[model samples]
Target: MSQEQRLEEQMLSQEAERRLSEQLDGAEKIDVDVQTDLLKIFQGQADGVSVTGQGLVMRGIRVQDIKLQTDSVAVNPLSAIFGQVELNHPINSTARIVLTETDINHALTSDFVRSKMQNFELNVEGEIVCLQPQEIQIHLLANGKIGFTGKVLLKEKGNARPVSFTAQVCPRTKHKPIMLENFNCTQGEGISLEVVVALMQKVKQLVNLPYFEFDDVVLRVKNMEVQKGTVTLLVDAHVRQIPASASNS
Candidate 1:
């Protein structure tokens, strides 16, 4: 390649790295390590990128020690080698994501629900039920309730009972508070275990937290599954690229 071509390739690579670094700025409790090379720029290919990371702490939910691994990811050579980088094309990749039950519990109790129920004594737990192609089932328990007189009520001794709900994780949306859908629970005679309005409000607020934003990218959960006490999410994200002039500025 001519010196002019080499210089342009270096500029493209540097621009890509800068954009990625800006996207990950201020990420909480998550550490991402990514390596990229432009050795094949002259060949019109980007096949020298690898990513691996561990201990990604989810903000609203108390999930810690999340791990992500991806092998060498190939990209459109012409786009990356040139000044215009279009990531719209799908790149076949092998990846693995892992999360533990303890992380789920932490996420549930960390910010939204747990903080909202500070007036009442609350104990929450989550259990992964199944892992399949694109579905996840989780059983959640809230062991106490707030009384009418503004007092917290604990579970009774002989008849200890708790409010429990079964939720399924599905595709996420920008307007949705969480991936949990079709929430259902059991009820006894003359008793109704309905979700209160306050709880719903808190949930909405939780989903609007700052941690959910990904710079100019829109990220949504495409699928999720549970396996061996862990839940893994397949996320789909779209990045809004900055204009060339703005980036240059």
Candidate 2:
């Protein structure tokens, strides 16, 4: 058959193929993965949130940049290569980039994670991604709305970049649902600023990951101030840095 004919048939088809193929052939299982909770990731709007967080993690430069600047060092005196001390090819060292809120934002569950779409509940919508310099922040509100704001800081590894970003997960309802709280940025590098913006735009087009496929999970990881295997979010709670059995005297 001609390619044009195939195309025409596909376009003119009255009904899309009815389950062209079935997994497990014709067999079916009664067991299904029922979500026990709802996953939430607050995307607060520009003027709707009050942001607050600390203890930033380090997201250094890309390995590729360091790899390319290995011999591009400044050679002094007679050691200068070719007398003029030109930067050699294939230098490897550090990656200089404007680490903005967008970098951290992209590394968020929004762009940080690359998996199937998951479940998420949000109260507000943040502004489109942006970049400035040295400071990266997001506009937030008490209603859980947020707008990404801030500037680029670190430009390379060993850049002594003290970076961190966080927010409190205030669920709309009394009971907080399964949420990707303590949310942090993930691997960021390998693209130019323009590319990052464009990629972020693509992410906007794609379905938000945590909306459709994520199941609510409430596992308790050890909090720094809490004992191992302990999960507490109360005053004098270990996770909250308060002893469970001991109180300030």
Candidate 3:
């Protein structure tokens, strides 16, 4: 590459990193690699893009580490001149996310996640029951199983009762429904079989969604692994647009 070409690459890399940082709440470190040349920029194409980050927080959820790669991207040449990545068409990307045990526990307690868990309703024996998670902890185990211990308040007919349970979650293939196994009540009043069955069905439905869509992005899990102290997930994302600001906004 010529001197001018190298300089252009470096400038694009820095701008990519800055834009990625703007999309997150915070990060310990972020690196961006842009594979392109002046010729490709003039043609409104990028050879590829790779990003790596650690301790990244997005939308109040903290990730331990993440690596993302995109195939050739199509952009507007005008946007490139202003250091903006305006996609001309949807792009396909692969992402790997690593979450440590601590990250999981902290996310469970975060106000953003907790707010989503509060007052969750379930149908048990034709009665509308509200489930509010009070405390939850996750343990990554061997054999693709995750163990959880949590206390929840189950409100039925305006009366609330605390129920604590220990359970194991096992995910099958990407196409199969997640299995909730060995759910045992550890404290407080035990949950009934009917409620347990209902909860499991609810979990299966959520985990088996066709795709998770948000903010002009659609994500589908390609694979997942659970091991001691860590959980890792591989995802395929279809990006319609890149956010230029933090998720909270």
Candidate 4:
């Protein structure tokens, strides 16, 4: 790589690192061994999710803005002889978002609940984000991570909410294919991209961000002590073409 390209790459890497640090610095950790109480899952995160129609509309619930980590990869053939190409390798791109307590903290709990001597844990019958077509699932895994598939919804049954998210948790790009974009904090030539939407489309949000990502996510919060809900995810993408001269100078 040329010195200038090296410098640019370094800057991008630096920004990525800085963003990761900031995220970790501000993160409120949830212990994997400790199961948390129940909390509400918002249904309105659909806003800004797409430039299409307003997301699902419900009676008593609204989709809260959700934090997400997304990833997208593109595979292209360097050269095609005839109708056949040799091989295509995968190029992975990622993105992320951090939501505050006020953002997606529909779940709530307090230190007082943890203080319960005998009753160490209580299953909080968290409120469901009642709505028309729940877009996602309220997933409570065994590792204490609160999560949902692309089909965001709230069907928590005190024990665990049944997410509305289906196998097609990931949404697809309506206008342009998400697989054709490359993204960086700084604007450049990569194809048209939206990290957040791509994540929701792939139904693979949070797959890119490992720090906040839960392996076998679970709920550890107590019912009455619930104060905040922890939702972690990452988003990433790769563009079809970068204006070579603009980005690669």
Candidate 5:
């Protein structure tokens, strides 16, 4: 490649890395590599792109580490000249995402995730009950099982009480819902079996969602593996566009 072409390529790669870093809430490290040639650039195409990050937190969701590589990408040439990557077509990629036990627990308590678990209404024995989660923790166990312990505040008919429970979660395929193997009250009064089953069913529904969609990206997990202290997910990602930088937004 000519010196001018090499200089342009370097500039594009730098811009890509900068934009990617800006899209995250926080990260310990981030690297972006854009592969393209002058010919491909003029055609508004990239050979491929690879991204790797550690301690990435995006939209309040924490990820321990991630590696993603995309196929040929289509973008706008005009936008590329101005250091902006505007996609003209969606790009498909394979992603390997890793989360540690601590990452899982932190995400469980994060505002983004806790909002979905807190102050939910459940119908129990012909009575409307409100449930608020507190002190949730999860441990990645061996053999694809997760150990969970949590405290919850339950209100029924203006009466309130705290319940703490330990449970086992069995991870399954993407097509299937996670199974709640067992539940045992560790403190305070035991809850009704009916209420436990109802709560598990609600959790299963959330786990069985087809895909997770964000503003510019959609992800579907193809497989998951659980080992002691870590969980790894193989995922397919369809990205319509790179997320806009906070500064730009």
Candidate 6:
């Protein structure tokens, strides 16, 4: 080949490589943004009392430290604009209930009562356990006795009825908070429970974060268990894409 022709070909190849590099960089940025948004949503949704005082605390898997491959992005067109992502880290979290006598009474009388059951009332004290990653177990004292009572009553001193439940997390909206769907107690013939939405809303309002929403991404609980007085959950979250305009804002 002529010298001039060889030089021209080299320049064209370099230009193509530069354009590809820029595209890859842009895709990575989008991936990071999506992951960051998901973490924010998780933190926001996690702000609530499962029992009282100490609620949920999400840890590990820093957003900035998350890494994504360019090839993963290339496979999905939406990922090119938003970023293809996967979270394989152990999600560590804690939920503890430490309340004063007054606080405990208020929680029992107001929050624990259901509108349908007027006669249903009881005092409870205990620690949450998360030794297993599939469910949250609770060993509490009912009326100072070891037991838990609800639609089904199981009571015994120092041998309280153990309550356990699993979580099903999902995204309810774009760039919003996630929801724990069908949280059912799997002990004493099993019973489904619902989180107090009003309380959650109040907690969110108190935080007053501007860009927070509800259920921005979907999550599947891979492992969950309780140890001592804390419940820990390991989850895999699926972060969906947010519109470019909305994300920018």
Q: Which stretches of candidate 6 lie above 4 Å from their native place? A: 1-214, 242-248
For all predicted structures, in order, the TM-scores are: 0.36, 0.17, 0.86, 0.19, 0.84, 0.22
Query: Please, what are the lDDT tens digits per residue for candidate 5 over residues 110-209?
Result: 7778766748788887888887888888889987888888888878788888978788877765676567687676775756787776666655565557
| lDDT of candidate 4 over 109-205, digit per residue (tens) | 2222222211112122333322122232344333433434332222223332322332311212223221212212221132123422332333332
- Superposed by TM-score, candidate 2 places the C-alpha of residue 88 at a distance from the truth, in angstroms, of 62
Q: Which candidate has the highest TM-score of all?
A: 3
lDDT of 1 by residue, 85-172 (tens): 4543434333345556656645544544454443322222231111111111233222211111111222322243333333333323
Q: Give the range of the ten consecutive residues with the poorest summed lDDT in model 6.
A: 45-54
lDDT of 3: 0.80
Model 4 weakest 10-residue run by lDDT: 32-41
Query: Candidate 3 — which pairs collide?
Result: none
lDDT of 3 by residue, 121-143 (tens): 89888899887778888898877
Provide the lDDT at 149 for model 5. 86
Candidate 6, residue 88: the lDDT equals 24
What candidate 2 gets wrong by more than 4 Å, as runs, is 1-133, 154-236, 239-249
196 Cα displacement, candidate 2 (Å): 3.0
Candidate models: Cα lDDT each: 0.40, 0.24, 0.80, 0.25, 0.81, 0.28
Instruction: Judge candidate 2 against the unseen true structure and give its global Cα lDDT, from 0 to 1.
Output: 0.24
Residue 39 lDDT, candidate 6, scale 0-100: 31
Residue-level lDDT of model 6, residues 37-148, one tens digit each, is 2332223221111111122111211111122111111012233223222122222222212323332233344322222223222222232211111222223222221122
RMSD in angstroms, candidate 5?
2.8
- Residue 219 shift from truth in candidate 3, angstroms: 2.8
**Candidate 2 residues 69-152, lDDT tens each?**
111122221312111111222122221212233333444433224232232221113323332233334433434433333323
**Local lDDT at 17 for model 3:** 85
Q: Residue 16 lDDT in model 4?
A: 31
Best by lDDT: 5
